[model samples]
Target: MDDTAIDYAAVFQALPGMVALLTPGLVFADANTEFLKAARRTRDQVVGRYLFDVFPDNPNDPGASGMRNLAASLTRVAATGERDAMALQRYDVENPDRPGEWEERYWSPVNAPVFGPEGKVRLLVHRVEEVTELIRARGGPTGGRTRVLEAELYTRARELQELNERLRRAHAREREVALALQEAMLPACRQVGHHRVAVRYRPAVGALNVCGDWYDLVDLVGGNRIGVSVGDVVGHGLAAAGVMGQLRSALSAASRVAMGPGEALNILGRYASVVDGAESATAVTTFIDFDDHTISYSSAGHPPPVLVHPDGRTEFLDQATDPPLDACPDPIPRPQAMTDFAEGATLVLYTDGLVERRGEDIDAGLARLADSLARHREEDPESLADAVLLELLPPGGATDDTALVIVRL
Candidate 1:
């Protein structure tokens, strides 16, 4: 053989899955065509560059361990002058065409050190077998005992899938039941004395979980005074809805005999603490005196009501705030706040879900609500309520259940 004149680069490039020669300083000395193809790069882009700079870890993925694991394997191979084999790794790579997008990949890597005449490590030979397809086809790692384990895993996975489908159907049925219960308990929009009332109830977007948000309007004391209540029970699903039903019934019974908003909330709070799983509920109760043309209200850690005037003025009723119901075993008297009720004024009461958004301060949400109300202040009660919802929670915007009541007196 003409050993002195032989082209060793041709042999290195030809024999490979994906192979790269790294210098002692972890700089890429050379890489095969297969390595460049897998990296979505060219020879000019990869050669003579630091390995990490050429192929950095995916920044968006916090669990990306490819660079760290490969570096450790190379270091071990260089220090001990022995081969280092790594297990399957979830290595994400950035798309060359799409910036900030990562493609998921798996690799089985082996690092072996090359020695110089002095018996010191000179270059590290890194080889990677792209086993992403193989692992996915086998549904897991495959080896000597994997065939038997894979069969068992396949059987268990099918059984689990069937079990999950059954559970999903059961949850759907429960959600339907809860929705029916909620709809039956909710009062329809109607005229209460001289005022026109409108109500809206929307379930949270996505999923079959039913939440515990409700609104009510009841005539108080000889049908002259009216009581409006909006409450949200903590959590969701069947348990929360059941608690909401209990609270609604208790509040209705208490409002009949209670003197005002403060007394009504105080009674409802005491009743809520006794009900199972109802301790963390929050509410707002308001009483309207038609004869006196006045409005008195109280809150139990709930969002304050927004009062919109006929002439396009708006104000949030933030005073007389108290802790959520059942926050204390023996609750204190909820103080009441009163304001003049103009003939054409509209009062808006709602659950927090109507205004709250993820990653935003509640104050911002309130400001948005106020702006929406001021924009639609001239519309009728039903149209105004609908407009506010469309503005705050457009399609696919709500993450929690929402209940809203609008009263135009």
Candidate 2:
């Protein structure tokens, strides 16, 4: 596949119909070529101006309701985060050649919401179709009998549109609730002894921002040790999140009393066998002991953690890897690995989303991560975490959720 970057701004300018991008507050962000041509305006004249300020109601038409009606439709879209199509109306645009002159026109206008990552209406897509010629062909300004028939058709179309809008709103509400639940279950970042720690969780682009990736940091009973883990469940959405919460809680609880990372995962595997939707989940656990300067780790079909030394060397903690949770029919012991670290080493634990790409070799992804770690080995954990994400993720984001934890020793 070609790795060339796409110029979305150029694409938007080339789109066929009359379209404009507006902020939630109705300020014009951009307008396509057709839109500017139809309005007889330049991009410099409209962009960054308020919608009504740019296209105010004509002073000559005392009874003109075009501005009022269009404002109502746009307001509904911004407030409800839904699309709104306005009924046919008479709106006039200024005749650019003639100062203080308004040319009468009719239009079919629609406003749709654009959402940001947190699911709020970040912008509004305002699209308008000029129907002046169609109306004039029917019969002059009023359209005679044709106007009445068109009104009836519009009424029926609006009825169906409203029904579909209601269904979409319900689905959006459910998605928000599920996302909130997952966020509440995730642990907040905390320092591990004198070392700095940073954590980040990002859901996939098309998954409604709901995914089964999670990370945890727990202080062990002894004062000098801490447990950190990252996990990914098989699927996405509400069910996957529920399973993730259960498994995370079980493993966190087991990490306290269990002898090592392997024992803790063994307990979690047993618990996962009984939980619905918990099969085939992958996880990696690491116990960092500041006093002993040692790192004990275990993996359950998860990507290996990377350790970056001060001398610009990178190491993968891959020796303890085993099959995913609940993969074996009967209970069995999990593998465990340990390694010594220098005082200035950085340890990174992450889910597979950070490395895996569709139709690409997994080794390529691992090398990408190793390169990023080596380049930024001297950065603190917070900055290193940000650098890794910026280097590894695509422009739009990954296709799967990512959970990342970085500990600076």
Index of the highest-lDDT prediction: 2
**Cα miss at 35, model 2 (Å)?**
42
Model 1 per-residue lDDT tens digits across residues 1-409: 8897888989888876899999878999999989999889899988899999888899988878899999998988889786766666668778888878988777767778899999999999998877555445444444524644444455466546645765787777787887788777777655365568888888777634457887888888764689998999877667778888888888877888988888889998888888988877999988888778888999999999998888878888878889988997988888989998788888999999988988989999999998998888878888998999998886875879898999887
Question: lDDT per model, in order?
Answer: 0.83, 0.88
Work out candidate 2's RMSD over C-alphas: 14.9
Residue 242 of model 2 has an lDDT of 85
lDDT minimum window of 10 residues, candidate 2: 136-145
Q: Which ten residues in a row have the lowest lDDT in candidate 1?
A: 135-144
Q: Could you tell me the TM-score of candidate 2? A: 0.63
Q: How close to the true structure is residue 226 of candidate 2, measured as C-alpha lDDT?
A: 93
